[model samples]
Target: MNENKTHDLEKERQYYTNQTKELLQNLKEINEQKELTESELREQVMARIGAEKQLQAAEKALEHLEMALKMTGAQMTELQEHIMPDVHKLREYFEQCAQEAQLEANRAGIMRQAIYARK
Candidate 1:
């Protein structure tokens, strides 16, 4: 009977040891999973920050492009305004030259008539 008692106690001890080992393995797996989750979270945060920076850069570039376009429009308006007076003066000069040529031609015709009448 004493030998049987020792045999039962040994079986109980083996069962407890197996339970402890399983619990330890479960705790280790939980810790490893937590670390992996933390690492993934860190990666996601870094990626978000990088995307935000790129978005800001794109916005800044758009602003510069808009400013440049506005400047080009303003320059075009200034050039048009600056050249209008020269265009008007050129038109007037051509008109004046046409009038003077007409007057000289009429005078030459009158002089020829007088010379031919005398002859």
Candidate 2:
């Protein structure tokens, strides 16, 4: 009877040992899964932060472009109001000079023809 009790106690101890090892393995798997989830969450957070920074930079660039457009419009207005009239006046002056030169050439040609006829 004493030998039977010792044998039963040994079996119980072996069973409990096996159960403990299985529980430990389960705990390790749970920890690994948690770590993987945390890593994925961290990666997602970093990606979101990068995207936010890019959005901010894009917003800043848009603001600069808008300012440049406004300045360009103002410059165009100035050119149209103040400088275009002078350019048009110069063009007219050049046209008038060209007309006068053409008239003089015609007069010279007419004089030459008249001289040739007389001859």
Candidate 3:
């Protein structure tokens, strides 16, 4: 009977050892899955940060372009104001030249008529 009890105790010990090994394996698998999940979360966070930075850069570029366009428009208006007086002066000069040319032609025609009558 003592030998039978000893044999039963040995079997119980073996069963407990096998259960411990199975539990350890299950814990290792759980830890591996957790590590993979953490890595994926980190990657997602990095991607979001990069995208936000790109959006901010685009916004800043657009602001600069708008400012430049406004400056160009203002310059065009100033140039037009400066050139208006020159355009008026040129028109006045052209009118004066036309009047002088007409007077010269009349004087030449009167001289020709006087010479022909004397002959």
Candidate 4:
């Protein structure tokens, strides 16, 4: 009877050892799965941050373009105002020159007639 009790106790010890090994394996698998999930979450967060940075850059570019366009429009208006007086002055000078040329031509014609009459 003492030998049977010893054999039964040995069997119980072996069964407990097998159960502990299986539980450790299950725990290891859970830990690996958690690590993989954490890695994926980190990748997604980095991608979102990069996208946000790109959006900010695009917004800044748009603002710069808008300011440049406004400045160009104002400069165009100023140039138009600055050039109008010069255009009017140029037109008046051309008319005066045309009148002087016509008067010189008339005088030359009269001189030619007088020379022919004298001949």
Candidate 5:
């Protein structure tokens, strides 16, 4: 079924694109925030690394399945549906962490200014 195969390929491509978009969106936001402390930077880096690993694993799984599809007719729909929610949660959690870190940095900056103004 050429049509079915074509459709599956399209879906797989779309999922990968979505993952990349989420990863990049969060990274951009974190980077644009003021300078982060060591632990804050580590948190962002860990989140980014986790996202990247997921993407790489998905890519590898897709490649393996593409090859196996010829022999097994396996479908990727199940994997896509199952993982989407978890990915969304992960993205949200990372965004929250970044926002918290940014807020803390802003407060610290304000405190520094206040102390300096008094001096």
Candidate 6:
């Protein structure tokens, strides 16, 4: 009877030891899965942050472009309203000078032809 009790206790001890080893293996697997999930979450967070920064930079660049476009529009307005009339007046004066010079050139050519005929 004593031997039977000792044998039963030994079997119980072996079973518990096996159960403990299995539980430890399960805990290890759970820990590894948790670590993988955390790593994935960290990577996702970093990617989102990078994308948000890029979006902000894009918004800033668009603002600069809008400002530049506004300035260009203003410059165009200034040219059309203030400078085009002066440019047109200068163009008319230049045309008048060109016409007078052409007339003088024609007169000089006629005089040269007459002198050649006389010679």
Tell me the tens digit of each residue's lDDT in model 2 across 9-113. Answer: 999999999999999999898778666655665565566556556555655655565455456766478655665565556556555655655565565556546
Task: Give the clashing residue pairs of candidate 3, or none.
Answer: none
lDDT of 3 by residue, 1-119 (tens): 99999999999999999999999999898778666655665565566456556555655655565455456665577764665455456546545654554565455456555544544
Writing each residue's lDDT as its tens digit, candidate 4 over 61-86 gives 55565455456665577764665565
RMSD of 4: 38.9
Q: For each candidate, C-alpha RMSD in Å?
A: 39.2, 35.9, 39.4, 38.9, 32.9, 35.6
Q: Pick the candidate with the highest TM-score.
A: 6
Score candidate 5 by lDDT: 0.62
| Model 6 per-residue lDDT tens digits across residues 3-96 | 9999999999999999999999998987786666556655655665565565556556555654554567654786556655655565565556
Off by over 4 Å in 1: 74-119
**Model 5, stretches more than 4 Å misplaced?**
1-74
Model 5: how far residue 1 lies from native, Å:
99
**Per-model TM-score on C-alpha atoms:** 0.53, 0.55, 0.53, 0.53, 0.39, 0.58
Compared with the true structure, the alpha-carbon lDDT of candidate 4 equals: 0.63
Query: After best superposition, candidate 6 residue 18: deviation in angstroms?
Result: 0.9
Instruction: Itemize residue pairs with steric clashes in candidate 6.
Output: none
In model 6, state the lDDT of residue 64.
65
- Give the higher-lDDT candidate: 1 or 3: 1
So what's the TM-score on candidate 6? 0.58
lDDT, candidate 2, at 104? 55
